[model samples]
Target: MKDKLARNISIYRKEQGLTQEELAKLLGISFQAVSKWENAQTMPDITLLPALSTILEVSVDKLLGYVAQDKRITIYEDEYQTEDYYWGTEPNTACYQVLQLIPPTKPLKLLDIGCGEGKDAVFFARNGYEVDAFDVTNAGIEKTRRLADRTGVHVNVFKADLLEFRLDTHYDIIFSSGVLHYMKPEYRADIFDNYKRFTNENGMHVFNVFVNKPFIAPPPEKETNAYPWQSGQLLTYYHDWLIRDSAEIVFDCNSSGIPHQHAMTTMVAQKITTSP
Candidate 1:
């Protein structure tokens, strides 16, 4: 456990481009103390874990190296077999809004993370963008491929888990509609960092997440499928980017014909720098 924590701390600190002295200054500790922690010679005081995690842009669980036993791949496989458009067939409204905000240029290269049925990916491909879409389940990928064929549009659809997927190419537009929030909280920072890293300069990212709300009841205790963001939490991850559009709204959940109110945070931001 100590080794894992030390390794994670070192990796995250370097990812943020902070030296021991710099991280120590942020933590109000001495450089030697930071070095010791990274060296596995000592641990940070328990009380400092929260502040340390906040500065490193990770959750405390991640700092301590908690691994999520994710069941999304299996759950999604079952869901896709029963409902083709479990989330909906129409592209999200935010996707259209983001298209309008894109600068006038040649057709862009786009990637859709967690693209279930390829509706949005096909929509973009039909409009002339080179699109690549991925989902974790084979059923989802199969559905997306069929949708692309039915629409007479070409889309590269594959099954890949977001946590382990690597990008061979950068994209001018990265769209993830309602998918990211399903990640475990401890893993979100790394996922967001990857999004920024694989986005081309001046490219845009459009996504949405469920946010914690007093009015919305929590999912069942045994359900680990969704992780809701704290209010205003999503924007904090994009501090180095230029926010083009954002909204917090409460809406009806019509995707599965399930009638329920959901509080969500939607954002469209442009990459201004290579790092965030």
Candidate 2:
């Protein structure tokens, strides 16, 4: 564990172009302590694991260097491939509940960020919303376009990275599911800040994330050295935005045959208004 933690720390620190002293300062610990940890002479305490994970961009389990012996469930690769994961599944049922939250109004401008396979986008268009979806995969974009044509619904799907793409218009509802969770904690705040920028004053922002906590007794093993609260493709955290309009907890009592702990959550925040 000590050797693995040291290796992970050194690798990430090098990638970030940070020296040991710089890393120590960020962690607010002594240079000697950082050196000791990197040299395998000492280990970080458990209470400090989350902070260390945030600073190092690695998971707590990875910090301890314990690998999962069991196979993990693959969530989805991109928008198109996600169809199999949601169709006829309990997760899809939960997704329907979210879709129902959109008010029944014609020409409601909608931005489906990280729209996988255009399922939600197509659904929105069929239900009378002007849907524009964006995803990073070429395959997903083509497939979504084909689906829209076949269904006789007009959806503008773009094959581009949402992070780099600029939205030219404001939307009534800007929504994402299973997207924010995948972002590293270090970048999650920045992503939300950008969302706030793109949203209109009256627009609503809705998204899902894994809340911090483990599910069931004898918890599952970590998949990646990503973060303490999130595993591979699964992100869990509460909304940190200041102007939240509403929030809710939709527990997944039965998801994928495994008892999930703090696995399902939804939050809505509105762009705040100020006097002119």
Candidate 3:
């Protein structure tokens, strides 16, 4: 692990165009310490791993040279080729509730991850927020761009896979609807941590995930693209943040033209300060 960390630290630092002294200054440590870590003469404290990984734009697991097995991109691309809005055309109810909490007088920067058809992205742009939205498929991104143009709202749309997506700018509000649940368990927490890092102080994050419930069964055997979260797991990730709202509800979904019941965990949290 130490050897791997050393190799990754040197590799990532160079990849970011940061010198040893620059990296040490960012970490608030001495250059000697940075040199030692890369030389495998010493290791960073466990508590510093999160900050180190964040600075390097990677997960701690990746910093430790562990790779995540992600296989959802093909599934999403195939789905997008056949359907325009797999979720729906309208913004989810959670999005409306989150908008009400934002200050009406302020024009904040917003990011809509997994923004399909740009419904929520268009809604935010039309309401005076600067919006950037992205999805895994070109089809979804194209639809988002077209919707924004038709609505006379300005929204930047791009194609990105969430598993490999990196934030280039911090946002005041990051909205992701019905997206994180598809992630593998090991990758979900790291993604949320990254979201927190890319959110400015006092910024709010609003998202929803499928959670386990007696009444809501798993997807059919033929469905290989679903991952359900355990009840209350989402809230645990926001222990250091101010939880504005949280709820577990059963809802009906007809995104695929077949009606089904879904149990979901919805949450809105504000980052008041850096995590300890």
- Listed in order, each prediction's TM-score against the native is 0.70, 0.55, 0.70
Q: How many backbone clashes does candidate 1 have?
A: 0
Which stretches in model 1 have alpha-carbon errors above 4 Å?
1-74, 219-223, 274-276
How far does residue 120 in candidate 2 sit from its true spot (Å)?
0.6
Candidate 1 lDDT, 1-276, residue by residue in tens: 777687778767876889899999999999999999987899999999999999998888867867432345435677788654766577778767866888336978899988977778888888778899988777788888887888899999877666545465799998888677667666678668877898899999898887889988653333456656877888988999999888999887644445567788898889986555
How far is 180's C-alpha from truth in model 2 (Å)?
A: 1.3
User: What is the C-alpha lDDT profile of model 2 across 138-169, one tens digit per residue?
Assistant: 55666667677877899888754433344546
The lDDT values for all models are 0.79, 0.59, 0.79
What C-alpha lDDT does candidate 3 achieve relative to the native structure?
0.79
How many steric clashes between backbone atoms does each model show? 0, 7, 0
Extract clashing residue pairs from model 2.
59-225, 79-116, 79-117, 210-235, 210-236, 210-237, 215-261
lDDT of 2: 0.59
Q: What TM-score does structure 1 among the candidates reach?
A: 0.70
lDDT of 3 by residue, 1-276 (tens): 777688678767875789999999999999999999998999999999999989988888878767522244535556666545655567778767867898547779999998977888888888888999988767778878877888899998877666556565799999988788657665567577878899999889998888888866654324455666888899998999999999888877765566788888889999998555
Local lDDT at 95 for model 2: 37
Model 2: how large is the Cα RMSD against the reference? 11.9
Instruction: Indicate the worst ten consecutive residues by lDDT in candidate 3.
Output: 67-76
- Residue 190, candidate 2: how far off, in angstroms? 1.9
